[model samples]
Target chain A: MPEDFEVNPWDVKGKVDYDKLIERFGTQRITRDLKERFESVVGELHPMLRREVFFSHRDLDLILNDYVSGKGFFLYTGRGPSKEMHIGHLIPFIFTKWLQDKFRVNLYIEVTDDEKFMQKNELDLEETRKWAYSNIQDIAAVGFDPDRTFIFTDIEYVRNMYPLAVRVAKKLTFSEVRATFGFTESTNVGMLFYPSLQIVPTMFERRRCLIPAGIDQDPYWRLQRDIAESLGFYKVAAIHSKFMPPLTGTEGKMSASQPETAIYLTDDPKTVRLKVNRYAFSGGQPTVELHRKLGGNPEIDVPFQWLYYFFEPNDQVITAIERDYRSGKLLTGELKEILIEKINEFLERHRERKEASKDMIEVYMRRGKLATVMWETVHGLSV
Target chain B: MPEDFEVNPWDVKGKVDYDKLIERFGTQRITRDLKERFESVVGELHPMLRREVFFSHRDLDLILNDYVSGKGFFLYTGRGPSKEMHIGHLIPFIFTKWLQDKFRVNLYIEVTDDEKFMQKNELDLEETRKWAYSNIQDIAAVGFDPDRTFIFTDIEYVRNMYPLAVRVAKKLTFSEVRATFGFTESTNVGMLFYPSLQIVPTMFERRRCLIPAGIDQDPYWRLQRDIAESLGFYKVAAIHSKFMPPLTGTEGKMSASQPETAIYLTDDPKTVRLKVNRYAFSGGQPTVELHRKLGGNPEIDVPFQWLYYFFEPNDQVITAIERDYRSGKLLTGELKEILIEKINEFLERHRERKEASKDMIEVYMRRGKLATVMWETVHGLSV
Candidate 1:
């Protein structure tokens, strides 16, 4: 029993090893050559890709090959609606929005309202449904092209999704899912069937699909690839990102359940400052004298990691900040203040877009390109 | 374990004992007092009920009490579309039609296209879907009032049914379903989730629901009762019928997979005669002289059981035939000829109605009362 870290669809714990995860999950690393190839297709890569934050991949080369051959690939991603949205939840969506812009491909966002209700005891169907609608506005705030994007919850669009979901579930057996998901006899049947629904959007288009999500969701794509080939569809391609470390320097990702430990997209500037100052873990020495003598470790510092992961886009500025922090020139208070300002700036713009998105939620939530492709393929509808 | 008979939704083997099944399923036998109560509500009982072939019940007394108090109940039953319908498959529909006509209640018929695809090894999604549409015409042939009846396949009506199905699935755990359905690790995840869909129609109406089906489907209602009260819905009442004996004199019911031992609703008169003459189990002695001297057994005779179970409507005529056969006055050939004539006559009328129903299949298949109720309840749709 290796207890150093555990990851599945439902739970994450301990300090995760990214390289080891790539090895264990049987996914390929995003090599320098692959990065250069991606750069050729979409111009200069996003900072997340350059910094290895969006670190690992499955079938990236194949998707690149298809794209270079004049065939395009769309994107698939999702959120489980159980609580409020945090900046950690926005990580993939922000990057995904960039990809959609660069590639001009359709993107489908699945809101797993059914999965939330099935997984949470206190969350009823209505509560989860309401959360899904709210989460849709947060996602729309990322500025996805409404004409090419579709956002659907399982309950609302089951008529379009379930026919294909049944086909996927028909190909799967209990033993196969149990092994893939580590499901026990006490697991609810809805959870067992849910991976099939999640897999449907990957095959929603005739072209290839590239999923941008945290590495914890890799197991579902692994199962999808095993069955996709036989179903006459392309295996889904995925780009896996590292977790956004929580403010308290937790080994795993930030979670919505602990409000104080996470900086939500909706959090005000004062709340962000208070959380960062009070709870952000630091790696500096005990005193200013000892701190100047012994350099700090930036890898374990939450404020520095947050900047490096998302906020600090300029490489030269980030390098200087890291060097100053490591040499004890930049105090912990200074680094915290830097992160707080950048986050508040981002949230201010995001809150405006979110408010403006209130009316457009219905547009993105309606049937769009991906839904048309799926309905046409499944029902022979003329779009 | 008793090997004399077997019964479940997916498989039936051996000779089933009605008495033993009632006890094993923990259901109550319909006593004369209950029969009298039912007679008071629906007029003189149908022959199927009077003969005790449609024998056991779960909560029939409450349904009758509600009916007497003018708080009515609706009928719910279904078919798994794995293959073409046989005469044995129509027994419940015929009896249910009588109940619907007598009580003038709304009826909801579910064609389990999803369950069939999940359970069968060779049937594909499209095949099962086609079978479901075809089977809907056969159900409509039973003369259900199209205005008051709603027939839906799991695939077509999932938009309206999935919300309630999720609520039901949340209340059930894997272990409970495995125990109830005898599901093993090899069972597909869809089969594990199907009972939730099957349980939805019970809660479609605000009033009580009475499901009339074979004893094989008892496990689903048993599960429904376990969670129904907590959900603030009435526990589904059910009327259980014995299986219609196969033409081959198999201990269990007729199967659609074996064409020779079963008479399909589409079979011609000559095919029905051939099946009855060649495959119908005989209870008479081997030699003609020995048969004339010795009495035959109507209790184990497939042809006699068929007449007693469904075809023959006259009790005095059936009794006379049974007595003549038991006294050696009627031979096996004579008994089989009588069953063949009765079956052909029944099928003639059924075929006419089925052909006539083809045009109205679209009408009966459209969104009706139950779908509107469910869609409004789940989606707040005003139309």
Candidate 2:
């Protein structure tokens, strides 16, 4: 059977196509405060100041415009469950987590089970639940505090909060939902209402919401901000990131569903070594001589981008690899060998904390929900 | 204040205008089973197989249609937080509580503290909680099983069940809601979503929703039914009562907002007697000769309507009252005396048992919520 078309910002490779994402999101003016917030999150100056992998923004100017007024908001970003969770997946989560810790405001890392369930034809809740749990671990591994963060399943809260869900449902329409989600006539009502569910924590009457995600999801955030005002609430803010290509295959980006295309969080050392060596989507030829004359194209080389995101806090190693590749002295296999060792060590630490991280995930989810829940309780329909 | 064109059904005079209600509901056939359900609940078998005050429906047909198709569904109904329910409020509650007992299906009754807060424009949450508890006792007086019934307050469940509410909101629009609730744009968003909140229980996959209200609320049910099909949901069934005119006052129905217009469930014999003798929308004449010739119009007498609702379970007393009233053999004072004695006895029994009944309400609320929570855990999103 043919696989149905399944492309959402949270899933699509083009989810981070910055220009198109901004057009789609209808966002504007990346502000100085957002940049400052970005700097505060990263803690140090970037190697590529002119090149922005973290792209697009909304209501960012408002924060800057109000900076002298001494008011600020919080941050939000999330995952669509645990599919592969490669380095591509970590860019936004890690950065957003950093922003949250630095800013000292509420953070909400939503796990979009309801989005996945509605987008997928099958109602395999267990798979969704599994994906949620695994993705939560990845989020926790990114290091958000249990006290300041929140994660929740749609079904869990839908059961717990009938009145609130109903209030949100009334503010939206099929036309608006379809516009936001790219829903077709065949789209389920669940999907139609799904965006509002994501946006709800933002309006919370009290907790000002700031979203962090790849540029692709900016459309959803923009829709939420508009609807919030209609519901008589505060406009939400967001930080958007650029796309990171998968290391292999022609599927456009890294994906666990396509094994050769991406490296898993649990990738064994040998597997990582083999995958990088064999299918890193090289810019160089099979023979070294042909490649020396032609030179390497940095744009399409997945290994270079991978190094940028993962070979962090160390320029000596990253520069050496870049110098070797520029001079045609470092063979693709040699680079793979280096990444294999680097990635393996990273996964080793991840696994060490993976079991201990269950409590961490629980804490993020519980705390995140508590912040929103507490605010919602006090301000609810009255606000 | 002119009260912005008052239409509170709690203010209906001697014969409710069913045709006007049906015209407003805009349905051709409300279905026979809905009427039968109401009759079964009200304990009055209409000889004409007639539809009375409850002239509109939403999912009443869906329910009838479901029953016709041999599928079982539960009934849903609830009340607002009346501090101490008067004789007027029990017309719907007693009937709905009976349906819960006979049908052996799930029942959910919501106490709308959220609605009261908006209506009274007050913020005393403790008083709302107090009213929730107080109203529960009056609800328990009708005797529903604690195991089968669930009672919820807007404050308690809104946060947990907002997803269900989101569905309701999606199916309805602001203009549509305004039309149902009779408000302008300045009305609180909480009131805008009030009908949707009332509706969340109907979509309760575990509990079938059947609303018990007055004909004044018919517009809300009519809109709910149309939207249910649009959203692929079962409609809420309804049992609407003709209004219960007040014990005192010169005109119209009982109203809690006006102290003289209602008989509180806690009123003692002295209060009942005094109020009845002095106030009850009299049909008596100023002169003895004129009264003898004109007699009394029981149809226009508010006390007779109250007696019919509260005092006469059998036809004999009603017929005798009617005959004496038309013949002028019964003075207005005599009729008032009968009503006062009947209502005093009724209120006394309720007051005596209220403390115990209040305890039962708490148990019912906890058990019902537990059942609903479990159902959603295993079965997934119901209204």
Candidate 3:
């Protein structure tokens, strides 16, 4: 069977070509000038931005213009509770936390439990809700400020979200949704309406919103941007990130379904070390003699890519590791060992924070100041 | 051009054939046996059941069986609130009130403000919500028990409905809805997901539920029954009513869009008289002498149908009216005058109750014991 390798809100397949996708999706590239402008505002870029992993954008220049003029923007992102969070699932949340801290902005995280239930045939509503609560542990562990952040599941916070969602759904027709997401007759009606819920956060505040997510989700914002201004709001801005490569190779992103190809946040250090040693795809020669003679390719190495993407943030250290690996001085096992150590160290603290978050989840889950302000703005309720 | 009489939840056109619709829709007839069974339980039959205004049903025998066995069922009905409520819109509400009073069961009234907004191209969310509140006034005038009845609009009560709606949406695909409603690509996503919300009231209580609505709404219950037992609930029972004939004729039902043909509850007695005198479809001779010699067809007279359906509940009086009209002793003007008197008297009381209901709406509007009970049942919350 032939695979289309298409990327949309529902499906992700094939080895995605990022530059081609930027063109196909009609999003603007993250130019060098924009990077400098972003760095100036944040003091320093997060590693994801610095490494070009946060690659493409839509209306980002306008958001930056507003931010530069002292008109701040809020952050919006989400998770679908289909399964446990793997290491790859943390990419956007980690970057969002950094963005939140650097910009001192409010962050709204939507848990799309309803979407997961509608999309997955095997999962029940109760199961999706369970995963949602568990995933909140991982999300809270990323350490967003309780005062400036609000986290809510769709089922629980529908009272706050549904009014805006209905407004968005009113303007969208089935043809537009099908054209945007390739939705066919088999798609559930809730999944068709799910984008309306996703788009609600973008219009939550009357001010600008900057959504940070993988490029796979760009189609949603495209639909949102098309209908936003007519609904008496600004078009949503987005900072698109590249998928974190799976452990086996760069064919696709890490997946929770393929447990062997990803490391879970709850995995013990020993398990992490074992998985990294046994499954991490190497770019070295078959023989040590040839590797030493011809040198290895760090460009295609999964361990090196993971380190560069998130784990090893120091530029000098990363440059040294890349150069050493290219010269065959850093063998595959040595590199895997280093990558495993970095990942385990990060996970150790994350695990502790996640454990603590179980008791404190309600603090972050409350309908706080931002929700009240947005509700008032949308409903025109006099305070 | 030839016209096809089409009827569904969203659109109704041409001259509907009630008997053919019951056959095409695959619902059971409200036979003499069922009518006797109903009257036995209620001790006196509502005019609708006795006159066969509510002409068809599905699984009503099961509900009656449960009622006989002491396992009571609730009543579910709704209004779209697209416009002002005309006298014709009172068919289901008046009958539902009778069911609630006789059966002593809970009644859940869904005011589908979201549905109205999604289906009407010209109406906005705020306008639909305004109509919903206004229509609630009319619904309240039907005199449902405040303690036993709960009325909710889709937008305001989404928190209570969304979880069950998600479950229903999970089991329903676009194909099923399209096949059921003949929905094209032009349908909005909200319109597609609305059946899920419509079906939630059936599962509000763990016991059986009987939905009293027009036959136009049978498609929604058909979808609901197909998936009900799989969700661990009984199939919903529905008693379907015929459309109240438009004042102009049997061409369509009364519509707020056509003010000349509809007697709105808010219409003044003089306007009601003017509308009936000028626009009510008449089956009489051109001259009084010709009518006295030839006689009139009481079966096709709009005024006679309205009185027989609801206003004039006396069987002997209705039979005398038919006999007099057929014998040319009663003219169309006299029949219409009698209908006008009956309608004005009914509206006078309805308006008084509606006016009084404005101050008392909060009692019924509050999320009372049943809402909390259902919420706890769904979420397993201890509060």
Give the Cα lDDT of each candidate. Answer: 0.87, 0.63, 0.85
Sort all candidates by TM-score, best to worst.
1, 3, 2
Tens digit of lDDT per residue, candidate 2, span A1-383?
54322335746643234554466457664545556764654475353321356556676555444433556676667777636477677767666765666566667656777667556644355667777777777767777666666666665654433344444554555556556666554443445546656766676535456776666676667666766765566788765666667777323557767788888887888888888888888765567786666656545567766776554436786777777776777766666666677778878887777766776665555545554464345333332
- Model 3 over residues A3-94: C-alpha lDDT tens digits? 44677876667788888899889999999999998888668988788899999999888988888888888899999999999998997999
What TM-score against the true fold does each predicted structure earn? 0.97, 0.67, 0.96
Please state the CAPRI-style docking class of candidate 1. Answer: medium
Give per-residue CA lDDT, model 1, range A1-383, as digits (tens): 75689888787788888888888899999999999999997889999999999999998888888878889888999999999899989989999999988888889899999999988989988788889988989998999987788888988777887877888888888899999989888888888898899999898877899999999999999999999978778999999999989888858778899886799988899998999999999987788887888868899999999999999999999999999999989888888899999999999999999998887777777555555554444421112
- Candidate 1 local lDDT, B31-131, one digit each (tens): 99999988987789999889998899988999988888999999999999888999989989989988988888888888998899888889888888888
Candidate 1's C-alpha runs over 4 A off are: A367-383, B367-383
Residues B1-383, candidate 2: write the lDDT tens digits.
33222344223544345556455455433557656764555465442125243445555655545544556677667677746677777767666655566556667777887666555544344566688777777877777777777777866766445555555555565556555655553443445556666666667663346675676666766676777765566556665565666655434567776767888777778888887787788777766677778888887687887776657655677789889887888888888888787888777777776755766765677755544563334322442
Per-residue lDDT of B23 in model 3: 85
Clashes of 2: 33
Order of candidates by lDDT, top first?
1, 3, 2
Model 3, residue A124: distance off in Å is: 1.6
Clashing pairs in 1: none
By summed lDDT, which 10 consecutive residues of candidate 1 chain A come out lowest? A374-383
